[model samples]
Target: MEETWNEVLRDLSVPEDIATKWWSQIMVQYTESARIYHTMDNYLRKKFEIYDIMVKDNISERSAFVLAMFFQHYEHDTNVYGDSIDKNVEHVKNFFKDAGINHEGLISTVVGLLGAACESGSSKEGIDAYFQDLELAALGASPDEYVEYITDIEKEYSNMPAHFYRSLRLKVLQTLLLIPKIYSTDLFYEKYETQARENIEKEINEVLK
Candidate 1:
């Protein structure tokens, strides 16, 4: 992933020194002991896989999208979800400033994408829909893979009482199930929609039991 990060930074015309410094910080942040499901090797990698597909289809504002993905979770904290979003937004702004990136349009697009992520809501059109769908692509994983995802997430919340955790998890599943479409984009909707619904229903049943 270091190699990939470096390549992306180079493609974006970031200086070698700045890229190296950013990579070092990313390594430390992502590998922290508190992170489980949210690790670079897991959640972020999955999202990037979807991003790659979008790239193949020639998505606009590619650089902005990639940068948004990186900075969205650059400062994540499981203990305080709300605060994490604000911190990540601030960190992203500071990163662009420190990197001496002066493209106001690119910066605005990246920041807007990050803000959309913080809302955790779906968009009806535009790249924002694709971005939101990418974040939730995991829901369409095969049964076994989905189970693994649930297990990893459970590990992340192990400090909470099992019953309380189940309650929260059930509510979340129910809320998602109520959405008109779990994935916002046509690509994601066609590919993962059915499986995602099935997965959510099965998990909801398990939580109820």
Candidate 2:
């Protein structure tokens, strides 16, 4: 069988760098290492809630809202939220009431970020403007354009193992995808450059055949 995106994601496991970044940005501010497991537990539970609802309702939205949620949360410490984290947590906890299956941790983080972003008020409008620009950039291109672009890159880099090349490429692509919404300023360039180097050293180096 062909690989689904979720399968690709699961095979890679969570990146240690991502975990460390997350801990540093959000968790460490409020809790200790002992709480990380519990926090992960909460994230997974929120993810499952979205998954079950999505599966039950079978809404076939092509937009991949859950994945979008995950990206927003992972990259931004904030999501759509109001008042205290406690108050916002409940709203996020229930957003998946009828949505279908998705990657658990990914969805939860995104949901949380969505809450935080909304809480900030500026995020929604800003992201909306950014995506408008993104849509214009896409023009009337076919969806396969992306698949073909990645495939071409893979072919050109065939000397290396596909997994290694793709992993690094994926990180770069994710960064580009979120640059406007997540970075918004050049101040994060150093951080992203460091992350790129780290990805090359860790993921690409090991996975290369």
Best by TM-score: 1
My TM-score estimates for the predictions, one after another, are 0.92, 0.23
Worst 10 residues of 1 by lDDT: 118-127
Tens-digit lDDT string for candidate 2 (48-67) = 34334332134232223333
lDDT of every predicted structure (CA atoms): 0.81, 0.37
Candidate 1 lDDT score at position 24: 82
Candidate 2 structure, TM-score to reference: 0.23
Model 1: how far residue 137 lies from native, Å: 0.5
Error of 1 at 8 (Å): 3.9
- Displacement of the residue 161 alpha carbon in candidate 1, Å: 2.6
Clashes found in each candidate (C-alpha, N, C closer than 3 A): 0, 19
Error at 150, model 1, angstroms: 0.8
Give one digit per residue, the lDDT tens place, for model 1 in 1-209.
56667776777788999988888887778777887888888887877777777543656777787778887788767667778788888887887887888889988888888888735565565777888888788989999999999999988888888898889889888989998888777888999999999999999988888
RMSD of each: 1.8, 19.0
Q: How accurate is candidate 1 locally (lDDT)?
A: 0.81
